[model samples]
Target: MRLRVDLLPHGQYPDVVLVIDVLRATTTAVTYLERGADALLLTATPEVALALRGGEDGSPYLLGGERGGLPIPGFDFGNSPVEATGQNFTGRTVVMNTTNGTGAAHTAAQTGKHIFLAALTNAHAAARRARATATEEIAIVCAGTDGQVGLEDVYAAGVLAEYLLAMGEFTVDDGARIALTVRRNSGNPLEALSSSGHGQHLGRLGLGEDVRFAAGLSTSTLVPALTLDGDPPEGTLRFTAG
Candidate 1:
């Protein structure tokens, strides 16, 4: 198998793609599933998420997302793993639209045969899922902060790659190598995150606890995989535990 990591969202990915947004998005996604959320509908914008929740489709969905790393004005919950930890979402779907992660997931769904959300919280499980499902290649796509590559996401990708490399033989690209190097040079997960640009920004906003929560490695076994309900663009990327 071949492994490649995209420091930022790019062109077509391999057969299996893992999306990472360690500062928050992907971590919150895994937490939602771990807390019994039936499904997560990822939207490109907050407007779309709100529309879906208020639509007459009869599907009950809770609006959850963040803008500028803060909870949206009308959202039921922010893109926070810590907040999601105490909530029970059984039999309900969450419509999420984040500043970075949702857009990256949408891009990957356009070409990737299989897409899974990854973060420091569930690195091992995400890597195991990719190894078991990917036939030849796997791509780890990082949802950088506001279009530029975020150190936090790259570090999480390295963690995922490390687990994948341990499980089997794979040729890695330079992007993956860079991620590995970052992981090697970095301190613990929380330290790595707290030192990053985005992480520091969140800290300034009083969201440092979320970063600490996201730093936990191999803390969860749930792997959230994306499955489209319809075609691309118009279709919805529904993620569920796999």
Candidate 2:
């Protein structure tokens, strides 16, 4: 199988794109939706996120987003998986815009035949999905920060690549090989992310807990995949009761 990994959201080309933004956005989105949020409304701009929160959908939606590791002004919550998972968002919708994650989701939707959201928190499930999709080529697209590669996303991609490669004998491309090699070189994802560029910045901004949460592996069964319209059909994925 040919597996590719892209470091940025733009200029994408792939058959199946697995969007990764480990230190918070993607992690938090998956966590929130898993916790019971009706659905996640993704937006790339802060203005759009805020505006949506007050429009008709706002009543059942909670505004959540961040800018440079800090919660946006007046938002109900910032992009933190730890905090997001704690709530019982039974029938609520999360209106979210982040520095990376959501945009990556949108970008992947443009070219991927089967797009998925992957992170250290759900690597095994993602690998399972990849194996089942029966696709010969897959792309792990990272929601890089400000056009530069992000350590958290890349590290998570590396983890996923390693897991998928270990699932069975499958041909991997140089990018997949490199990602697997990096995952091995990192020793431990949490420690590696702690020293990462964006990770360090998040720590400085008092989001160390969020970083730790995002660094965890298989902590959730909430496999957030992108499909036309909204989330996938019922029973397509099963999650633990929140």
Candidate number with greatest TM-score: 1
Candidate 2 worst ten-residue window by lDDT:
233-242
lDDT of candidate 2 over 178-197, digit per residue (tens): 67777778769788789789
lDDT of 1 at 168: 82
Candidate 2 local lDDT, residue 140: 84
* Superposition error at 157 for model 2 (Å): 1.0
lDDT of 1 by residue, 1-242 (tens): 89999999989875999999998999999999888898888988888887776646665788889989999987899989999999999988888899999999999988999999998988998999999999989999999998899999999988988899999899999999999999999988998999999999999999999999999998999999886653423436899898
Could you tell me every candidate's TM-score relative to the true structure?
Answer: 0.95, 0.88
Any runs in candidate 2 off by more than 4 Å, and if so which? 10-14, 55-58, 230-242
